[model samples]
Target: MEHDTSLITTIAAGFGLALILGFIAERLKIPALVGYLLAGIAMGPSTPGFVADVDIASQLSEIGVMLLMFGVGLHFSLDDLLAVKRIALPGAVVQMGLATGLGMLIASWWGWDFGTGLVFGLSLSCASTVVLLKALESRGILETMNGRIAVGWLVVEDLATVLILVLLPSFAGILGGTVAPTEETVPLWRTIGQTLLEVSAFIALMLIGGRRILPWLLWQVASIGSRELFTLSVIAAAISVAYSAAALFNVSFALGAFFAGMVMRESEFSHRAAQESLPLRDAFSVLFFVSVGMLFDPQILMEKPMHVLSVVAIIIVGKSIAAMGLVLTFRYPLNTALVVAASLAQIGEFSFILAGLGMSLGLLSSEGMDLVLAGALISIALNPFVFAAVNPIINWVLQRSELARRLEHREDPFAELPLTTERKYLEGQVVLVGYGRVGRRIARELDKRKIPYVVAEQNRELVEDLRKKGVAAVSGNAADPAVLIQAHIAGAAMLVIATPETLNVRQIAEIARTLNSDIEIVLRTHSEDESQFLQKEKIGTVFFGEEELAKGMTNHILQRFAP
Candidate 1:
């Protein structure tokens, strides 16, 4: 009797529900992504009591996707992208091809049209830039080789998505006119050519115009120093370019947003734009995930369960292989390669956009839509678990074969390359690899003896603190050649590799030995087995702390007995 709930009201209700679920997800130590999906399922058309307006939700999600992509572009400088070209370009192309091919094969097995299958394949080929990055960052792996490669690969995937968005509609339109429901003939080739031309021209214009005018516009805006005005202008530019892409050039709004971000990245206002837009981006991005979740009809998984499961399996295997192969080929550690591959084994937000486009163009059926939605939700929900398994899987692989043996090999062709042009410092000094309890104690003892020493510690903060106390410290991994050089290992009287007693310690010790053949090497370990391992390397000294602890305990017991 109060009033009818309009679509807007329904969307608002769905959004509120999503926010609550997201909060719940965070509290439960689960990925917030799961919460967003659960929120969608609760308010979806298939659910009772709170049916959402799917159309409105989808539109809002479009904005969310753009903002998210814009953020990615803002953080990723062109220089960084070019630097990782060895992995970013080839890895992405291979990964996409493999995933898409697997998708097509799976879809074909299910008897779907070849074109529909191809579209579905293409959808599965993409790894979500947002999801993978968030997972890696949360796990504190963003600076590792795995993290770097995954980010580069995702960037490649994003570029592919832009091109696909540019051409998808025309391709579908052509296929549509060629098939049934074409009462009038349409020139497919010319239409496609014109669409491609328009898109290419727009890209060229943005590249040139963005490089020239955007910086100037941003500078002009900055000169005013009005926060409100600057924020308004940035949003206006984002929306204006997005609107133009959709209205004038017939491009996807997301593409325009990406281009706008790329332009904004070059401006001085980049950091401010990123900071200001985050609140809005988060609000919309949450809605997007929630909306995506709402599209999940779990019942469809029961109906077309095999098809969904098959596609998901293909995505995991295909994407993993593509990522791992590329990362390893580019000479990242094997452990890092495995982590990178596993992290990207799921489908992403862009996949949904492709499916949505397919649906609009009649290339996807209701069943196909449901299948895609279910796969996306399941993959996103399970991403944390997949990521968590990376280390364990790597450990297992390390025990299996020679391939794993070489994973930690630091004998790369550039191992001997020195970092600085200046002659080595720390001549006749000792190089200490770690600064842990044993390592640090040893360094102090050496200092008391007046033996000059350099500390090479991976903990950057600890290295800084040491330097402030008038210590010579090199900030980086002991296993890295650059760190050794920075500490002047070649000019040292001795090398002490005191890292944790892990498998990689052997590699570090070997590297130190290779760098200075005449320099004496000492190792500190907690176990007799570790002592034996170091002995095999003919280390000058091996201190087994646990054995000493055991002997002290025995002495105390005997003294008590004699007393």
Candidate 2:
């Protein structure tokens, strides 16, 4: 007997093409997302190939969306946002406004209605969180100060987008579009008020009840000691909460899943949850991109090339300029401004979601959706190159303009130590780089042992605190030769780099070696492969955190079983 195999065929074809093209993309030094999108295009009806069922692909995509948001929530840190709130909050809001305004102007030029312009503009405002994080991670800067600010800025944008998703349906009539007409149209204020109330109630429930129940549920499942069961529980919680929120409270699935992951973060099992669920989350995420590909009409590129270019400019140029201006206005260093701007110069998953919602509500036309997708494809494809160009661009500008050089070299009193007769602590001492978690512990142990050491930290506040406590400290990136000079690396006995910035470790090591050829060097890394490479190059004593932890645990167990 023959059986219906449409679902199986769709899954097989989607994953197969995605795998092949994704590998090719990586080999070509591009993000695998580009490959996934290409795969989807190949299987889409627009490409005249084996078209997967759009409806089935869409359902799978929804699951992917929920899982993707869940993973994001797991990594979301309130502390990180609060750390950069002074810059992130206002910067995100202002930058988003500028991008939106540009988008609206372009839409108006194209003769679209105000509602369509609003939706299109909002879609162009936010950067893709996935793409940004990946870029930062690859560069080993995700833990840097600028990275934190960028992540925090994106969080603000995400929250704003969630609010828009909630209120869009309510204001559908006023926006000059309606998915479905109501018996009597509700006043705009009334609709907004109702949405706020329901959202508040749902948020309260998640924070208050979910905080207690979800952890308890995970704890119970974990006690069963079954990995499969634990993974199932995580998936279930994400999907159930997301579906219930939409069904009962009229909240978006993305918002619901985000909250679920946030609440789950309070659990001791949060790391395990993230680790186990990653494979599944990643699988679904690919499907989500694939489904997005299916919706694109490639003729938009040929039919409206100028419109596409305008949208791309809004995303890449307009948004970037706004972010850079905001960061500079906040008195951040030019390096920080450049990094943040580069990070936000691409659009991704959230843009697609907003476009789809607008289209469903009749607030955005097919042409608008196509333009958004086209803009996303081009911008995402170019983001890495944009980041790669930041340093070169900054260098070129500095060399050409004295004003640029002055701005880049502007002194921060807090970040520089005055040269004086206090020279005793700067000689024959350990120069410890970074003042973060690992550096702090090392400092404390040295203090307890009465060892002379000087801290070279990037955070001015941290350096100030160290000095107040009578510890020798200088503030600036260790990778800077001047900062190393300030730390008296030439006279120092050793250099201990406690930061996990893999990309800069080699530079710091080389600088220290150049200054003091016989200085003992120690470094830390998160990747075993990186550690092996460093060790092979004789870059100094290297430590991989996980490997060290395993060794320590083994010693403890061996001691327990001692003969």
Candidate 3:
């Protein structure tokens, strides 16, 4: 009981440490994951006093993976998935094979047995999906061709990793002679057949049962309108499925998580699940990376520094080469190919699992673990630099030849930047707040006259919907100073605040006055009292939506009377 309490306490403490260190890492322009890893190192067995419960950390890491994969599946639209099919499928398999071959050769040179070498190579083949996704998001390239290819390639890598996770333990048991692949009653082929049958049944249940049942269950809960219950149910489904896959079918939990996500992808509840699971997923992911970092012993630098560096080189440099080859083969532009390659050049979560399993199975000692751990750390640390260099490299390549010119043209089909940046505000134009009924008619008139104007909207969904209709609108909180800055309030010739909410309109008018004391502010309110308050703030124009509708009706009556 004492030991259990201590374990719980350590895990709780480690969680706090991870969060604090993550902020520091962000401030320093380093990956928050690296900070989390460093925090884990500081709290691991090698460090002085603060040790985290390794078992608990491992379990949480599993949950992190499930949620992370689920989110990935949710975001992966049909278009994005179809875009990278050519490269991601064949390229992932070929690249992993090449990496494994290289790793096996290196291991043999370093005097490791074939079994150990195979595990080592398999570990080297994975790329960190979480890290790459975050990097792409930060660069605003998550929807780019390169980003699509990187994600799809990781998806392929993830499937291969799941296979490795299943095979490794079984192989270890067989090679160690603890369990024979073939027993008297069950021949090796028969055992394999049974295993396949089990896997098939499990998959059928998840795909068929999961697809039909999971969505219905979630929808039922959603109908109750209990946010807490909805969030809990999503978590329970993800965790339960992951556990069931591992416990019953002897497959990796990661595979179960992937399937769970794929099945849920068919549901309307996917977006809600993603939003709810993000916080938990991020917490566990930090812990997972930190634990990986803790495994790196700096002492190895003294003895086999060259070997460790070589592994890192292969991971960073070799992976890049393979990725570039695959990207180019798929007919992507040279710029996109380089970005895709550079983005996926780091060792990932599966590497930690592989190394840990190998250590437990007596395939690798502490020294070998240190080398793999060091390689993971060094590769991860350099990943940001590699990503940052991609744009510069692409620019340089673009200036080289005829091929470069074509690639550059492909990179930016619309070479012209938006007119929003030309001046502080969209001058001598009517700024529409909402693109609804009244605002739409006003915009049509403005368009007919060739007037320059900008639309600011607080509703992201609505903004995206309008964008599809070719309306120029920005999305954010109207009350935010940054939003006002982006919309360029200073030089605006006129402002149109049209919304159902009068309070919001008044607040927006106040913000407009704060930004530009000289610019005309318009308040589209439902109440006369609201208009008076807006007018008091030096707003030159005020249009009550209710009054405007009433006047239009009155004018129609007057015209009928004259006739």
Candidate 4:
């Protein structure tokens, strides 16, 4: 009559410890994720007492991954990925290569074999999508341009990792893995082509069929007015698609769930679906962090202190510096570079998964795996501090380094309006800052009424496109007084701040006011508190939240520009 209660005990202990420690972490102004990891470590075998089943904990964490990715998909669309592809795609690929190279260097220095070095290096290359998502969401910047770029970059990393996971098994012998050697050479390109085919098929199906069917299904279920059923349906779709994708298409569970969520987003009730499923998503996500913590063997830190430090340095310092440099090279601003770098500083689920595969293939020793786990734990715990340092570091660099200031505010060929710009746009016109969704809408409204405007956008590429289309736009952060002057703010009838970039909006507004005392100003904000603060400071007309805010801002600008 006896039965195993391992699952129940694992969840109970994990959640209980996570809650207590997480609360303490928050009270101490630390990230709750660090607390969750600590909770896992407490219940792990290495800690000695009442060890939770690591296998069961890992499975539970997978469910969390499925849900967390699904939620991200509900918000992230294909267009969002496309929006940052110019930066994210190249940035992720180059940064991963750099991290891998660094990993290989460290491995070689430690006298590891080539195969072991390759696997170890790759294990450090990818950033955890879950961790990046959590960081962006907590900062209330998940919908911003920078957030999209970071998430898109991680998406590319995940895709690349999935390809590596698939191909690594085929090259097991060459990589010194456990697979027995055969006379036949491993068909490397064949396997890669097959993987691409399967991946393409899965995506096509999700985009074409799943998009139509899932939304319809959600609609049918919601029409029934059963909250329980709707929630069940959403979770069922997430796990089912994830499992099926793994079984049928050789896709990662997280990627499968993400596609499922994206498809479901086409439905009218996508927001409701996200709302109803949040509790489960959050709960499972905690378990994911806990399970990650459980895998750590703290002994590695003590046994090979220098080795552990080296791994941490490669992951936190080496990878971050490389990624930041890549971002800057791509012509992204300093803040984007710093944020992207901070986002890449921690390795998570994929590292553990890759290391496990390495062990099975005999390419990595248990010692190497231990080092990876140690690095993951320490880096993840410190990731919050790294992110917190971004703004301060940016400020410090800008103030202290001439080169850094140029990187922050540099504008060149497209920084100034061309000499041929119409006099109407240079004077008695609206200075439109940002060309994102709100900015686009404002521009369209102005175009309809023939109200001349010039755009000041941080994205140089966007500005280039705008210019090609005969729009008067300058590329640079508006917080730079020179950028404002370039936009002819002194003669501008009104200034419309449309993008929610993390720049000094107040400073930009003050500069605009200083340049043109008679100019009117309008600003868009996502936070009500920020809107209130802006209004109190008389920093133009501040609109808060969503499309309505955009509409109101557009209407106000139109009224001022009315003939």
What TM-score, over all chains together, does every model reach? 0.74, 0.88, 0.69, 0.88
Winner on lDDT (2 vs 3): 2
Clashing pairs in 4: 177-361, 178-361
Candidate 2 displacement at residue 550 in angstroms: 3.9
Give one digit per residue, the lDDT tens place, for model 1 in 139-258: 867754446657777887888887887777777754541333452356768767988888887789888987578767877987999888777777777778878887988778888878
Model 4 lDDT tens row, 215-324:
99999999999999999999999999999999999787877998899899999999999999999998998998898778777888888999999999999999989988
Ranking by lDDT: 2, 4, 1, 3
At residue 500, candidate 4 shows an lDDT of: 73
C-alpha RMSD by candidate, in order: 12.9, 3.4, 11.1, 4.5
* lDDT string, candidate 3, 1-563, tens digits: 33458656756776778789888878876677767777777877777886677777766666776676656555655554544566678888988888888888998898887877877888888887777887888886664445666888887787677766666654565444235435534555665666667778888998779999888888999999999998888878887887898799976667777777778778898888888877877776776776665666777887888899879988988888987877666555677678877877888677777777778776666777777777777787788889899888877777777777775334321122146444423565556776555777778888897786777764444555565666556765465565666667776777777654454565677788787777676657667887677678656677776778899999999999995
Candidates' lDDT values, in order?
0.75, 0.88, 0.72, 0.86
lDDT of each residue in 398-470, candidate 2, tens digit only = 8899877766766766555556526766788899998778998998999899888888877665666677877
Error of 4 at 351 (Å): 2.4
Residue 136 error, candidate 1, Å: 1.3
Clashes of each: 1, 0, 1, 2
- Candidate 1: segments with Cα more than 4 A from true spot: 1-8, 173-186, 418-477, 480-488, 492-563
Candidate 2, residue 305: CA error in Å?
Answer: 1.1
Displacement of residue 563 (Cα, Å) in model 2 is 5.9
Residue pairs of candidate 1 with colliding backbone atoms: 40-294
